[model samples]
Target: PVKDSTAAIGLTILLFIIPSKLDFLHAFDKDPTKRPTKPAPALITWKTIHEKMHWSLLFVLGGGFAIATGSTDSGLSTMLGESLSGLKGLNEIMILFIVCLFAENITELTANVAVANIILPVLAEM
Candidate 1:
């Protein structure tokens, strides 16, 4: 949050001075023998490059299709429809805000798969 240069400098000084007297803690000390003998040579291989390119595209396409499939399921659609019914009594804007808040809260506590599975059937029923 240090915005201005002067304020940032002052904060930096304060932080460093306050921490100067504290002892430093570390998980482990370095071992010289374990260090690599030479800098690793730059990798240059068609197979390695091809594998990375291949898998990246494969996984991306696979995940995209899986998400699309999950969203359009009939039971899930029906459940969502049921839950979304009966909005006639409430203001549309307020309803949207409330629904967004509720959904955010729910998503925070549940995984995507669990949330989708639970809501899909319920929505379809609507």
Candidate 2:
């Protein structure tokens, strides 16, 4: 909602600071005996990175990028576009509608960024 760039930056900084301050406050106990005696775990420790993180999503994203790059490099997308070029004769509105439908379906199968990377170049060539 902030219109000024400086105001937006200040708001973002505050957003991060406020939650962190609150969390730090909550970390201490009213009874000294109940408080943590040792330092907290490091942010980038192997336990945090390997055990806590969900890594499957990263693999899926990497696969999507690989598929996009392969399709482009192999010229499969260009061939696909040329094969579908007959659709160019249709009304512009209909073409838009069909492309949107195709995109929606493709996104259901894979990540949207991957689909866009693969489809946009083909559409551009067409």
Candidate 3:
């Protein structure tokens, strides 16, 4: 029910911290009707953790966040806006369409939210 970022992060952390003991792999019986009242003890192992964790994806997302933070901190977002000032003579629709294409291409290589953070400021300044 909560839409707050802090709440979202807390809930995500809770899934790991609170449910770390649940043996989800062996939670239910093989038969469709046979079910355990509670999950078995967790079978924690390095291999299991490795298999379950999205480690590489986490780095990629971190890099995206870093890129967005860096661009904002370095004033590149504002510079982009200023640079686009010269293109004022161009059709507004064309300008937005071009920006959208650029954003979409960057997003294909990284994360869409990161690209949005990088590009939204430029559009706002315009």
Candidate 4:
């Protein structure tokens, strides 16, 4: 292969010129113990990782889903849809744009996934 030949020629040139001109290989081997070493960081164990992580993520997600269901079932979403539809003779596109803005604002106030979980079901009902 052309790649292998090129690499072989390059290595041959390096071996000849470097050892003959500067002798770098001899100098590097003359001192080995004088190099500095960095200490390794402590490894994480399963027990430590489990202890450090809070398990409330499941509860938060489940609660968000429940809240979404309740909000939809109570006709809040329908009211929101009707109210927004009255905004200066809003069309579908304008209503969608406003909804997107409100959705972004809610996501900024709360965590994004949690807000999305709540919003998606409500949006579907609307």
Best by lDDT: 3
Alpha carbon lDDT at 76, candidate 3: 83
List candidate 4 segments past 4 Å from native: 1-54, 87-93, 108-126
Is candidate 3 or 4 superior in lDDT? 3
The residue-by-residue lDDT of candidate 1 on 1-126, one tens digit each, is 556868966865565445332122222328655555544333333454566667856575555446546755546545555667775468868766766676677667645554555554544453
Question: How many clashes in candidate 4?
Answer: 0
**Could you estimate the TM-score for every candidate?**
0.33, 0.56, 0.57, 0.40
Q: How far in Å is the alpha carbon of 15 misplaced in model 4?
A: 60
Better of 1 and 4 by lDDT: 4
TM-score: the better of candidates 1 and 2? 2
Ranking by lDDT: 3, 2, 4, 1
Model 1, runs deviating above 4 Å:
1-68, 106-126
- Runs of candidate 2 with Cα error greater than 4 angstroms are 1-43
lDDT of 1 at 48: 49
Q: lDDT score of model 2? A: 0.74
Instruction: Choose the strongest candidate by TM-score.
Output: 3
Residue 8 local lDDT, model 2 = 71
By summed lDDT, the worst window of 10 consecutive residues in model 3 runs over 16-25
